[model samples]
Target: MNYTLHQLHVFFKISQTQSITRAAEELHLTQPAVSIQLKNFQDQFEIPLTEVISRRIYLTDFGWEIARAAEKILTETHAINNRILAHKGLLYGRLTVSVVSTGKYVMPYFLSGFMRQHEGLELVMDVTNRQKVIASLAKNEVDFALVSILPQQLNVQQLDLMPNKLYLVGRRLDDSSLLSDDPGQLEKLPLIYRENGSGTRSIMETFITDHQLVVRKRLELTSNEAVKQALLAGLGYSVMPLIGIKNELLTNELQIIPIKGLPLQTSWMLIWHKDKQFSPVAQAYLSYLRANKEMIVQASFDWYQQF
Candidate 1:
């Protein structure tokens, strides 16, 4: 009948993670501590909030209802705190951003200075594939979507941040055949591709279809990091963002081939649905980004422009 807010918070995290161990790790608490709190929270109710089957925890229907309510309470509390801070001349609130997986490497640089200015603002970033990011945008779950490929169906406004160039790169092998200016030479290398629903994969597919290049699809990995690893292991070549592979290129671990239609050009964009109302924090970020985008790109991405 009576549950504490701490218990509500812990239970909400447990619901989100679906594993006591993981919830403990995220909450920075011990497994035993999480178990104890969960038990204590459950003791307040006669019915079960969570159940275990096959060693995995699943929330009960009642638990789902409670978790949803708890989320609202937590969100409202955060909003109140933000409003209080705003009265004190601080731009404070949670700024949730859903970014396509590879965008993780780039969004941070743009977000750094703006976040530094608003110390009280919290950041919640969902680094997932393009599908999930688009889904989040459709659901209005985030303040911004950092993406290279904008969704066609969504009515959104975009601010161009920096150029995103994907280059066909392979290991710095001594094979002269792998280095070619001819676009037809693309058929030679076994291509390491990102899985479907990835922006990189989409671009790679378009390039393939346009050139009528029959590529050797060696692997379809799930993430940029995975594709990079496959490349390092000499599995295959991939069209990788220069931003993600700067160190490898500098260390001579990878080399960009000189092809006619290469470095698939796109822009990193800050996108938000046209109809979504802006929170103060979101508004501040948009303003900061618009005012300082040129400067941020100059400071952080000037090296990329050489290619």
Candidate 2:
């Protein structure tokens, strides 16, 4: 069966996004236009390709098989284009990176600079939580991930980007003000924990368990921003990344409660699949990260400390 590259691109995109509307948004096509293209591809085949239930789209078994083939074809096409661009002495390609939300504060700045430096490259940045970032990397859905927490799977190359320290923060006048710099004080403060499965939550759990301290409060939240807001509102004390609340610290909306014996170290990492081949643009982006690693870490420390 003969199908145009555009139809294959639509098929791949829809399969990747799992929703025609999202695929349309990504490809800058109207919903009807995307549906029509998908219909054309389905018409070329012997079996049904797509179905909708509860307004959600799903590919049939045959459709998935075709989508996988289309993926291989697209990958080869990209490789050929990269080879031609290399021959022309031009570095041109696409790189999609997934990152944890906390890293969103500084990671995008570096990525923006890299894109500016490599003018011909196209970049897509997906900022989500740490767990989502890991899933993206594991699925080979993104070129790389910037994460503060290590993944459960150990197959990816995780280069240390910077040290992320956890701080116990609270409203300036909250009951947690009674918390002294002593680590034992952690047992007395009402604790606001990150949502389960978070890298930060994992670290906190390990620290508390190792110390044999019973957590005084167990309110759980997901985002760093949510944790900070809860603390600022005097709901309870929270262990949060220093970068997440720099502005709050600067404004004195919240203050760090010095807690001793807490594990203060988790490194932000640039993670990618060990077996995945890097295009020239991807290599240059990684090189840019390593080249500025120390400077970036130091500046982040300085900026957070100013609060």
Candidate 3:
């Protein structure tokens, strides 16, 4: 009954990670420290909160219920802190955003200025696949979701930020004439791919199907990083976001293969459920984005537009 807020915080992290060691690493605490706090918290309750089976932690039904309550309590705590700050004409609160894996390259540009303006705010950016981003938005688990391909399944409002261009790229070829102009030539090179549910993968598949290109699917990777590595190793070519390969392109590590009607286009968007009630922090973020999105795009990605 005498559980401290700190105990709840520790337990919440443990529940999310499902590993005391990982929780400790993220919290910047020692393993023993996290274990001690968890034990202390569990001592206050008669029912077991976490049970270890085969050295793996599992939250019991009671533990799941407590975890849900802890999340609400933590949210309210953030609200209270922001409320106090607002009284003094200052901004303070937590902002959580979920973005597709490739959006890691883009969301920071949108967030940098807002973060500088509100130094007191706590922000969590979760980079995941498109499916998870959609799920988070549908479940109202996050304040915003950043994606290239719009999720039609969710009734959401969105702010279009910038154009996302996907280009067919491979390792720089020493001989320009080695690659042919024939449309059927691409079929000879293996095609690297992102996973099935990825926005980029969807776009790539659509392009291939529309063109009736018979490609050798060499590898299927779950992330952009892996696909890029595969490209660098001369394993295969992939249609990747130009933003991600800017440095590689500039350094001549990767070269775009100009296919007819190439560089598939989509706009990057910041989306939220239509009925989402924004927290004060979320409101501040949206306001900043609306006011400065154009400026941020121009400043941070001027080269992108030029290219």
Candidate 4:
């Protein structure tokens, strides 16, 4: 009862990040200040909330419970604030979103308009691989997730946004003989691959399997930028999202390899957990996306084509 919302907020950040340093950085507070607030909050509880083990912070059982309650309290508080703002015919609230790495290329375009319209809104975005993005959504750590491949394990509500096309690209070599539609030739070329758990990697894997094709993987990269660099360096051919490689393709820095059954097509989707209670801000964004989906997609495609 003695604890304040400020204290709860600090504790919640620490619980989420599991590191005082990171929590402090995100909270924009000095490390010592965060430590003092945490200590004071623990005094109010009169129970051990967290402990340092092997130089890493781990939450105690009580800490976990408190963190969960803190999340609910914060969410409800934000909902109430949003409702008040709605009554005033104003929009002002924070929106957190997570997207897979490939989505990074297109998500900014999708968000720019909405963000411009709501100058008072705060937007936090996490760009990670598909696995981490899905995990964040599962934990309710983010309000929405943008991805091409939806997890089969989670119950979620999704809106299809735009077409996501992936192509096989490599440095344009003078050897025209290397360019062929024969699937067997793929095994002879050095292939650049994405790290495991990448949605693009998964799709590529399936495509390879279905076609009974083979590839000589020369490198395993974790990010699109790295892969693009490797491709530019002629390290190997790679399956990459067109959005990520549009500029390269336009400039002829990267050439799409014509292969049998290639240019795999998928749809970008916006997803949220089925059990989540939407705040007014979340609802507003969702409605905005629904209304402008076609325009957004067209604008993105047009932008890419110009590159």
Instruction: List TM-scores for all candidates, in order.
Output: 0.84, 0.71, 0.81, 0.74
Question: Candidate 1 has which clashing residue pairs, if any?
Answer: none
Relative to the true structure, how large is the alpha-carbon lDDT of every model?
A: 0.89, 0.81, 0.90, 0.88
Q: Model 4: residues >4 Å from true position, as ranges?
A: 1-87, 303-307
The number of the candidate with the highest TM-score is: 1
List the candidates ranked by TM-score, beginning with the highest.
1, 3, 4, 2
lDDT (0-100) at residue 100 of candidate 1? 89
Q: Considering only N, C-alpha and C atoms within 3 Å, which residue pairs clash in candidate 4?
A: none
Arrange candidates, best lDDT first.
3, 1, 4, 2
Which candidate model has the greater lDDT, 1 or 2? 1
Q: Write the per-residue lDDT of candidate 1 for residues 8-32, one digit (tens) a residue.
A: 8999999999999999988889999
| TM-score-better candidate, 1 vs 3 | 1
Compose the digit string of candidate 2's lDDT tens values, residues 80-146.
8777877888778888999887788757666766777766677888888787888888888888998
Q: Candidate 1, which segments miss by more than 4 Å at Cα? A: 1-8, 22-53, 58-80
Candidate 3 runs further than 4 Å off: 1-8, 25-53, 57-80, 174-178
Model 1 residue 303 lDDT score: 83
TM-score computed on alpha carbons, candidate 1: 0.84
lDDT of 2: 0.81
The collision pairs in model 2 are: none
The lowest-lDDT stretch of 10 consecutive residues in candidate 2 is: 298-307
The top-ranked prediction according to lDDT is 3
RMSD of 2: 5.2
